[model samples]
Target: MAEEAGARREEAPEETIEDDDGYVEYVPVKKRRLLEQQKLLQRKGQNSSLVEDGRGAAESKPSLLVKASQLKKDQPEISATEQLVRQEKDMIDRLSERKTLMSVRELAKGITYTNPMQTDWRPPSHVRHMSEAECDEIRKQWHILVEGEEIPPPIKNFKDMRFPDPILRKLKEKSITRPTPIQVQGLPVILSGRDMIGIAFTGSGKTLVFVLPLIMLALQEEQSSSLGGGEGPFGLVVCPSRELARQTFDVVQEFTNVLREKNYPELRSMLCIGGIDMRSQLEVVKKGVHIVVATPGRLKDMLAKKKMNLDRCKYLTLDEADRLIDLGFEEDIREVFDHFKAQRQTLLFSATMPKKIQNFAKSALVKPVVVNVGRAGAANLDVIQEVEYVKQEAKIVYLLECLQKTPPPVLIFCENKSDVDDIHEYLLVKGVGAVAIHGGKDQEEREYAIASFKQGKKDVLVATDIASKGLDFPDIQHVINYDMPAEIENYVHRIGRTGRCGKTGIATSFINKNQSETILLDLKHLLKEARQRIPPVLATLDDPMDNVEEVARASGVKGCAYCGGLGHRIGECPKLEHQKSQAIAGTRRDYFGSGGYGGEI
Candidate 1:
């Protein structure tokens, strides 16, 4: 009976479904018992036509991502802004598609400075291979030390450094008789095309170290081939703050202007920062830029908008690296880095290099030379640090008394914007020349305040920690901290505003019961390290740094090595915890949503 049923199935012919074109195929599907077996045995047929119009199908279109990928392909109408952006993207794509003509490696990379530089003046290898005593003497005299394999010898004088006469004359015009400690060693490392991280005091001429090399780099690139429209930024300077960026831009302009006056190939530079006209920056970039000094936000925005490209950028300098990360520009910085297809000779310069930052910086560069002028996070010896304990209510009143200690060109730092304004208003009412700046102020007001202060029109510039990050004030004699900063690194920066450029200055900080013991502990150790006078309130705080090693070994939290805070370990660190919470809160928003310190200041 089973054989008979199989034979009947073979004769049924229900499996092969044929189309009108006569092509037939068998589709095997699960067989189910049905009450109407005869109806289930029917064959299924299809319309055989598979062409576009032959089938019931509509015309296809490019997907969102597909349409987005084609920059110049036919598409629907777009706005003027979109068209401009598309043009920029097309320009950047063309730049990236250019063929590489040569392969290069670090340590000069066969790219010698010849336009205005004298490579014939390079010191002989034997002279470069100085005896240990001579090297030690140079380092000791400058209080600078370097760590790396095959490190370049330090430059003794501006003349010995192979700099073009024009650059040297410009230096002399600026009254810079010789190289600072950082410039002594830093210039060689950078000029050799090696990546480097330079640590020095805030006012120790760190800017020149990167700037001079950048100028030389751009000069060489121009000598080989002039940058066409939408081509350059052979070098990039990333500053954390706008004021610092502008200062760098001015320096670049000064040197580039000197070169231009001498009738050298014009090296164009642009300052990309907030509060500036974007159209102006776009014009500069469109014309072609040899160097760009920019704040992280504006630079990142430009990169995102495809308005600028870093294909020709072989030199990258991050000024105030620690502050850049602290202000939450690390991601933006790395994103800006993604645009570089070629290798970059990266340099990171700052007054402080924390343990965490040091590690992260290493990962960003290719075998960097580390040149440290003093202990990382250590206060400047030129500044006399004094901590005073005062009640929160009476702190503002005592500020007047503190201002009397220093003459014109004073910086008063408060932790809050309201406090900065209140102090500024109070000082004005009390007949003290004061101007205020913070995150809350608009660009015009902040620039005016900084200009007033720098030109010495305003003796007292009341500000927050924003002013402390890499803003150079050569004549600042005193720095008064109205309320202590939350992080110890900020303390170093606040005090660093004074005591710059071979001059002695004073840094006075006020603390109250509201201040954290962690901050106090770090303050105590910093003062002790600097040999400054520690007040009674700070002196009473136990020194966590004393047994830091033992505690670190026991707890495995490393005892706050990240910020050099002696009061706690990494696990229990309030600053770190605050960072984690801020990161979780979506973005690193400032305490008051102003993106300033605690309260937008």
Candidate 2:
């Protein structure tokens, strides 16, 4: 093959164009390179078939070279799709560099400032607030106590606080005249920029205690920053369930809307929860939000997906802190704090404070001002608790009876999803206007059900523990516990649905020996404190020897058997002695066989 290629190269005519200082050349540039390629191909045995014919070899060599050039032209090149992807990646890198900010977690850890308790702080003269003595008297009267540090003096009215003018106006427009005991005490602590743990009953206006602070902080930050903050949330409110998150979001939106109307930048908020299309939430978040209210699960999922960022959040509120720990959000909450390294104001609010909540507070809050209203785990004092011993199978019968007697706008609580559905079905079948909400229902269904109940479209809202905490449904006439909660604290929240905002309401629990034995003692105590009637069956659970008179008083039972009078027992009754004397004289006359003046034959 090599000898044939050499013969073909020698046979081919060589032509060259000489330079100006010309010298003879054997081949032109194009033909010289082509002949060298053919010889190299022949030596490698690639053109061995053409080696058989000298004439065919010269003719096919040009064809083979043309084919090789075509092959090179047809080779794959970088595609538009790939090039566009590369460009997008480069753009993202540039954007990340420009958007870089301080890490919140690192800032939080690096903060070394300590908040010392104020021993001699006084109420400002400009504010129409209570004096230290007045505040202390009010706190003592309401059983409000601080575990660590004393908070600021309570505001006598909403106007006394140094809030933005618009916010203050909104407060009055809403007719929020006087603060509740918890609000009176908690608001001052939060507005003072201290980490706080608020322990109050379910309907003590705990929402506003943290929400007011959140709004104030956002307003101040915007006033300070010319460009405002980033797309991420500046305040993060984490609740245990989607419903509570949405409820909190509604409250935030209501007050923040005032900011927007006053020609301030809109204080945007995003609601993140499961059972909804996440893409919609992501789009809202991408457009930017100032506040984010979310459930722990959905919030954790968003953090993992990088759909939202909380590194810039300066305020963190855990609503229903105890419930969050019970719902298994401890790890998720820790993951959240990992992103919030910046020194932030932490607020923990719960109706009940178990040891778990205390531990969580110690870990999360920085020298928190603990404001506890009333005893922890105690239900609202305003609610009248009624316990009835109804068997599980007879619950429906007793429920119907109670509903017949009670007024409209009743809230029935069940322990689980299946019970919620069953009660809803039973109520509907009985021709009652009713709706159900539970974890099993979709987000839209649950929300619509709650809205309908709140709007009076449905008289009865059958629910599981979902509606037990932090949902403000106004004018709930009765809270019927169709099934006792496994957790005693939940009972407080369940009955708390009614008797909100200092309004009187009834909570009727269908207790049996099976499900309620664990919480019977606490239930009895709660009933006694509320001055409510205790059923005879539940009253028997306590020993008769212990506080018999007190038990009779709580049960509304008069110890007098003769006349059932409240002040005196039968032995101390004046009417009882007269009746006994008359009976004895009649008996003596009959036994003496009418020996006196009466002619008895």
lDDT of each: 0.79, 0.74
The 10-residue segment of model 1 with minimum total lDDT is 112-121
Candidate 1 residues 8-94, lDDT tens each? 658975555455899766444444234235564442112223233465333344578886768547667776545544543343344
RMSD of 2: 30.1
Q: lDDT tens digits, residues 339-417, model 2?
A: 7645788888888874334643565566778888876677788888888888878888788999975788999988878
Best by TM-score: 1
Over all chains combined, what TM-score does candidate 1 have?
Answer: 0.76
Q: List the candidate 1 regions with Cα displacement exceeding 4 Å.
A: 1-126, 129-133, 549-559, 566-568, 587-601
Consecutive 10-residue window with the lowest summed lDDT within model 2: 558-567
